[model samples]
Target: MPTIPSPRHAARRSLFQSGIGLRLALAALLSALVWLTIAWALAT
Candidate 1:
């Protein structure tokens, strides 16, 4: 029989999923866009 993953193991797996380099780059790009929008709003 296959054993199930415990809560901690599941959480760790998800953390690594988001820690991928491509995902990190995408997240950074999205954050930059949001900051730019906020800056433009404040300027106007």
Candidate 2:
């Protein structure tokens, strides 16, 4: 019997295969920085 791949793995593979992984990563990093800025502003 062969092992089966998970859906999450398939989705991630497709993301990279289509060259969207880098864009997605950059978007996520930018979003995180925005949140960090907000938190810092509230803390200060």
Candidate 3:
């Protein structure tokens, strides 16, 4: 009989494989938005 992986284990593996790219993209987008907001505040 083959052993099956738990749902938690499979989810964790998929997150490790694909989550970093998503996290990095989100960080970059957030930083850009913050920078633009600061610049706009200073200008006005």
Candidate 4:
């Protein structure tokens, strides 16, 4: 017998397989850090 997965399970499975979300989060964090550094330099 074959089982069908729900929408949530499918989404989680895709994320686990490809890790696109993780990469995006890492990129966003790096960008924020760079912007913060620039702002701090300008303020000082």
lDDT of each: 0.87, 0.85, 0.89, 0.87
TM-score for candidate 3:
0.61
Query: For model 4, how does the per-residue alpha-carbon lDDT over 1-44 read when each residue is reduced to its tens digit?
Result: 13456777888899786787888899999999999999999999
Clash count for candidate 1 is 0
- Give one digit per residue, the lDDT tens place, for model 2 in 1-44: 23356777788799787787678888999999999999999999
What is residue 16's positional error in candidate 4, in angstroms? 5.9
TM-score of model 4 (CA atoms): 0.62
lDDT of 3 by residue, 1-44 (tens): 23456777888889997888899999999999999999999999
* Model 1 stretches with alpha carbons more than 4 Å out: 1-19
Among all candidates shown, the one with the greatest lDDT: 3
- Highest TM-score against the true fold, candidate: 4
Q: How would you encode candidate 1's per-residue C-alpha lDDT over 1-44 as one tens digit per residue?
A: 23456777888988898779778899999999999999999999
Candidate 2 stretches greater than 4 Å from native = 1-18
Clash pairs, candidate 2, are: none
Of 2 and 4, the candidate ahead on lDDT is: 4
Relative to the unseen true structure, what is the C-alpha lDDT of residue 14 in candidate 4, on a scale of 0 to 100? Answer: 92
> How does residue 25 of candidate 1 score in lDDT?
97
Per-candidate TM-score against the hidden true structure: 0.57, 0.58, 0.61, 0.62
